[model samples]
Target: MALCEAEKTFVLHGVEENFRIDGREREDYRPMELETNIVSHAFGSARLRLANTDVLVAVKIEVDVPYPERPREGKLEFFVDCSANATPDFEGRGGEDLAVEISNSLAGAYRSPEVFDLTKLCILKGRKCWKIFVDILLLECGGNLYDAVSIAVKAALWDTRIPLVKSVTVDGNNIDMEVSEELHDCQKLDVTGAPIMVTVCKIGEQCIVDPSAAEELCSVGALVISVSRNKFSTILQTGSGSLHPQTLLECLQTGHKVAQRLHDALIETLVDIKPSENSVGFLR
Candidate 1:
């Protein structure tokens, strides 16, 4: 939905007045609903709806040989699929570029060991390891896809459980392993250090977090900031517009602060979610 000139002016004025059309102040996020462990066959899964944008994330694990150069570390890959029903623009192959961009950004954010320690997934150095696949499905795109995707990914990772290896036997270059049969004999992933991304849009000389589709069209430029454990993991500039150095600094400050608060709130919410709880459908 493209905004008309008058509609764009309205949004601009609203931002200049320090209030958005949705009545949210700068740096405030839209209402979000999160649910975890919603997929039965997946190792873990989560769904998040921020205002109108909806995202579902599932985590799957497989045993494979570790890369020779990084034998001590396991593999973590991200895949994003934008449903054509989400928007008309996503029809056919229209969303492929956006999906690739999002997947790449997520991969880069988790590349640092301090953000997500892949070594913890190693079953046997250079021999076998658990390769995690995080698959994201975008059901809708109201706005703020980056923030919503990151939060859902973190929650899904938190809910993931890895099967315990009971025993391993090696004979003449052949290796065999036994996994625990007990359903409860699994290890939960530690996602405390997982990065949270925040998108700050520079609108009318002020920066805002979690912009709606309409607001996004009104923005000149935006910054996507990924914060992990009180530190920045990746900062990427988006949009064709450029910002002055001072404004860029201010945007960073806003993104960092908003990301921290968002992360804390997300962690608290995940802790309270029960494994057997029913999913709150995406209608909201």
Candidate 2:
């Protein structure tokens, strides 16, 4: 995101007045579009568009042994792929750094047992468990990539349906399990405690929740806060600028408030989503 001095000044002034270039409030998010089950082949899938930034999340499940240390817990992995279609800069391996950063951030946010329960994924004590693979694809870069990715991830997980184990028989060391043949006899994951990330960008002593491309370029410091069930899951400082202790506290407070609102809004949106007969991947 490149902006001239005049453009930067204009954005700064707008933020100061609490009216962004798009006429949104400082703590308001841009228009967002979310759809679930976009990828029929995957176990669960969702696509979210926050203004121009677009992200696709797909959840895949497999049977695997649990980790030795965490015997009773299942495995959850996050993989981020930044496609070149988003930008030429991500053509080859250019987006590796950003991808890794986003994936790591997501891993940290979902690491807590309170936020997400991995034990529910365990079929047996330690012999068999469901491994969840969350694959995120970045299709565009408008701004606030982290927030959009997190929202899409949560929606995908909510849409995921785990197959039910009808019967499990253990013959000595060999164990066999039978999954239900009925398609509708599946269990939906509980995503009530999933985290919602909010990016708070500080521009001239004021903090903004969701910033645009031009607004991001003008910000000196930023904070990314992930809130789960009214508590903070992860908090990180982004950008090169430094902030005072008082300012940091203020930013955290703002993030907490904004995250809760975002979470509530997301839940309401999810409830309003109806199963559509037609799938709209990107055409719409």
Candidate 3:
């Protein structure tokens, strides 16, 4: 939605005064609702609703050969799909560009071994490995898509369970493996190090987290910061606007601070979630 000159001015003034249109402070985020294990067929699944934006993520695992150069590490891939119902711009293939951009950002954020350790997924050296596919579906877009998607992906991965491998035997050139048949025999992924992304928008000399769609239209530029283990995993500048050196530094500082808080809250929420709890579907 395009905002007129007056609406843009109103948003700018709100940022300057640290009072947003939605009654949130500059560093404050909108209300969020997160649910896990929503997709029964997936190994893991999570859905997050941040204000008006909604994102659903699912994790699927498959046994495959590891990369030649990284035999000890498994593969992690991200795929994003923007539903046409989200926005008119997302109709048909129009959302492909945005989907690619989001998927690439996620891939980059998880590339560092410190952020997401893939070695735990390896079943055998230079042979069998678990390939994890993270599929993200954008149900709605109000703003701050990167942050919402990252949080949802982390929650889904945390809920993921990998089947237990009972035994692996090698004879001549043949290799055989046995997996535990019990549904209870599974290994849960450690997602404590997974990165949390924070989007900081620069508007009228002020940097704000969780910008609304109207506020985004009034911003100069934005910074997407991915934080892992209290450290920056990736920082990407978005929008065509340019920022001064000092402003850039300040933006980074704000992003880092907000990301840490967000991560802590997410972890606490995930811990409190019960596997048998009912899921709050899209109707909510």
Candidate 4:
């Protein structure tokens, strides 16, 4: 629906020369900005903008009974909402499809316990545990939605602080717990193995990572690859176009390589982020 045969051929030739229309390498990700603790109401929060695509992630913590199956583990849930500001079509339910897609992708990425440790969030064996609610808001959609959302979610989880438990008491059928009242009495979430998703769009005959809006429109097909600590977690086919077996394999390998680089760069940038520095949301 987006491209003519001539345009597709033009994009293919560009990829063959290792020179994309946007002048980025086949493995290069777009520029991104990240900020933590933006929403005052949430326990932890972060906002990420990848070129024109903007995503916000907020973490909310609540006390709840441990699940019967996992009495010692916490719960992690994802909710995604598309904002009207992204496009006029997204004014209401127009963006529901996109929101569902993003949320499902995120859920799949975090499904593995090895990627995120929920045991640490447990308060008592069967009594109280912390449930983390990660709400994602799509403010814009330039391109590469999965990558931007994963990065933001990881950053927000890192910034999240769980309140320190001061005391816990369990009655025969009831439980009571007292948490630290001090605002600063909190613990940071250990997010060392969080995964990052990298999308590679195949245009004409070549594949490129982090496609621009125009590039996305021009691509015949795309693959979404999720990586955690250099390991593959999930791979999804997005666009309607199909790929040959050999090309699909090559694309998966390229995705792993690019995803690792992106993850490493993100860690470095996050560690380097200073609390004292000013972060301009969209203006910059």
Stretches of candidate 2 exceeding 4 Å from the true structure: 277-284
Q: How close is every model to the real structure, measured as TM-score? A: 0.97, 0.95, 0.97, 0.92
What value does the lDDT take at residue 215 in candidate 4?
A: 83
Clashes of 3: 0
Clashing residue pair totals per candidate (backbone < 3 A): 0, 0, 0, 0
Residues 1-284 of candidate 2 have per-residue lDDT tens digits of 57889998989999999888898888888878888988989989999988899999999999999998898998899999999989777988999999999999999999999999999999988799999999999999988999999999999998999999988898989989999989889999989899999999999879998887788889899999999999999998889999888889999999999888878888877776767632222212
lDDT by residue for model 3 over 1-284, one digit each (tens)?
99889999998888899888988899999888888998989999999999899999999999999999999999999999999999898998999999999999999999999999999999999999999999999999999999999999999999999999999998876779999999889999989999999999999989999999898888899999999998989889999999899998999899999988888888877887775773543212
In terms of lDDT, the poorest run of 10 residues in model 4 is 275-284
Ranking by lDDT: 3, 1, 2, 4
CA lDDT scores, all candidates in order: 0.91, 0.90, 0.91, 0.84
RMSD score of candidate 4 (Å): 2.5
> Which pairs of residues collide in model 3?
none
* Cα shift from native, residue 244, model 4 (Å): 1.9
Give the per-residue lDDT of model 4 (tens digit) for 1-284: 26687776776787778887677767776667778889989998999988889999999999987899999899898999999988676886898998888888888888888898889989998777999999999999888888888989998998889999999887888777899999999898888799888888887667888888778887778889988877888888998898888889888898898877777777777777787742433212
